[model samples]
Target: MTANPARRSETSRQAILTAAFDLVGEVGYAKLSIEGIAARAGVGKQTIYRWWPSKGAVLFDAFLALMGGGPGDDAALPDTGDLAADLKTVLSATVDELNDPRFDEPMRALNTEIVHDAELAAAYAERLDLPMRELKRKRLRAAKEAGQLAADLDLDLAIDLLWGPLLNRWMQRGGPLTHEYVNALVDTALNGMRQGAPG
Candidate 1:
């Protein structure tokens, strides 16, 4: 039997999402709008509105989908049991992803949206940042449990250690994302900012 027409409609919906994602990545979110998305997707404005409430919603979902975080789905962070190792594995991959020329444009666009639109910022937090942050927390707690981390170590501090340098690296273009760089991050995080680990 042939596929249902609803499935075909869903396919077109996905096509619209793809077009929005690509166009926003190319032109930037400021220039991206529902009308522009329609033109790019070859769909009608009403058709876009039939499914989404705003351009921010579409672009937010589009970026998530591109990141393998489709509707009702969350991206996996990593759970390899070895805390430093697992964090290293996931963060190393993230470093490489962030450093990619392909990702920079969309990320900059999304960053702008985060600042400009309160609703979009909330949507982005709900869909993307919070889950990733929770995953990082879970891993750090696990590391504490495994005795790989100091029992007195603060998870919040651990999280800062994990993300802070990466943020600096991206904004400052401080350095490239490399195995050596990631290893150094892990070491610096575990060792402390100004002093060596307790002897």
Candidate 2:
């Protein structure tokens, strides 16, 4: 009996993504190659090239999915009115995903490649980072609109204030991306960055 074409394609796609994750993790990102993922997934070189142009693209897609923000889901973000609480929850989830063994290799692949490959960096920024920035920015702006804080605020700066520190801490490995550390980050961000207290 013949299998369904869509099902077969999905199976192949999933296999390729999984193989990319393992290869990027086992070998450093620079060492990862299309030949490697194709071989690991038991697919032809053309199969990978046909779907994804570069290892960075594959890695970005794989890790973003692992982070619960994949397959065009990057536009999704939680906004619970309380900016502090919302950011804390979202960033904490991000921390958990980053620290997961399943996610470690692919994320590292994406992050490192962005440093050296301008094209890949641009794609990654467009596909992943911009969404993250938008999500956080929207939440902060909403907080301001709700009169949760003062007016005439710089929303981008506000996002940077709350979001960048956690990212900085993680990228620098300043400390464990622990819940305590993340909560501290959220607290520091809200207290230090908020424009003014509510009346």
Off by more than 4 A, model 1: 1-5, 70-76, 193-196
lDDT assessment of candidate 2: 0.77
Error of 1 at 54 (Å): 3.2
* Candidate 2: tens digits of C-alpha lDDT, residues 101-153: 76766676677788988988888788777877777677777888787756777
Off by over 4 Å in 2: 1-6, 67-76, 195-199
In candidate 1, position 25 carries an lDDT of: 71
> lDDT: which candidate is best?
2
**Each model's C-alpha lDDT?**
0.77, 0.77
Model 2: pairs clashing at backbone N, Cα or C within 3 Å: none
Q: Cα deviation in Å at residue 138, candidate 2? A: 1.6
RMSD (Å) per prediction: 3.2, 2.9
List model 1 lDDT by residue over 25-100, tens digit each. 7887778888888998888999999989887778777788886773333545577875567768877887877877
Model 1 error, position 122 (Å): 1.7
lDDT of 1 at 197: 52
